[model samples]
Target: MYQRILVPVDDSDTSRQALLEATRFCHNQHGKIRLAHVINLAQFTWGGAEFVDVGELQGNLRQSGRTVLEKAAALMQENGVEAETTLIEIWGGTISSAIIEDATNWPADIVVMGSHGWTGLDHLLLGSVAEGVVRHAPVPVLIIPIKRKK
Candidate 1:
């Protein structure tokens, strides 16, 4: 019984579907869920060093993370699941690292997230956070992937 579920969310449709799935699981299992939104400050600095305002850019990113988390939490509420949320600002390491860290610290029973299911060039270029998590996370991971048509 996975009582504590940690879910990573973004603004993507895949993420929304993952949340919905998690909500259903939680409702069925009487579990709790934590929604996480990560802001990669490490990626931001190099990109912003030349032109963007560091403080403003970071602030905007933080707000965006909050907004995403809020929306996710709302969705959970609508599904009759009360979800806790955290906004993680990572100065280093990949997004997967942040998620895994939280999962360990929170001691979640499992991690539920979304996967874009990119292949070939797209997978090579974008890399897969879900893959990284599946390989390294201490607990079980459930990924809600994009639906394929028959």
Candidate 2:
């Protein structure tokens, strides 16, 4: 039923699983996949260290984001799914917020993402982006949980 699928990817096993699920779903529906990576410049600038050049750091972050998107797109292509990529620069916003915004702007039929599955104290401290996206996204969200190794 989904025509345009939006998948947010990062350099994590959870994200990889999410992409795999998105690929399978898109392949079944003959849908296109949009892979997005958001770079939050605020993370690199919060300390405001004089030694670090913000511009250079942002450039490097953008490059890394591009690489992540490229690899995810390549994987989708290998799975016989059409894929598109986007790199978003965030000055001040949570990653979940950016993803939700992209979903709305892209007008995606659904959002597919991975959950880190943090619970208890870790969940409280770090917060969950997947949870936030599920709460705020305008479109349907499919969360693929990352299996923890015993």
Candidate 1, residues 10-126, lDDT tens digits: the string is 999889999998987789567889999989877667854778778788888899999999999999998889999999899988999999999999989999999999999999999
Q: Which 10 successive residues of model 2 have the least lDDT summed?
A: 42-51
Q: Identify the candidate with maximal lDDT.
A: 1
Give the range where candidate 1 is weakest over 10 consecutive residues by summed lDDT. 41-50
Q: What is the TM-score of each candidate against the true structure?
A: 0.94, 0.94
Please identify model 2 stretches exceeding 4 Å from their true place. Answer: none
lDDT of 2 by residue, 58-126 (tens): 889999999999999888888888798999998897999999999999989999999999999999999
- Positional deviation of 142 in candidate 2, in angstroms? 0.5
- Residue 141 of model 1 has an lDDT of 97
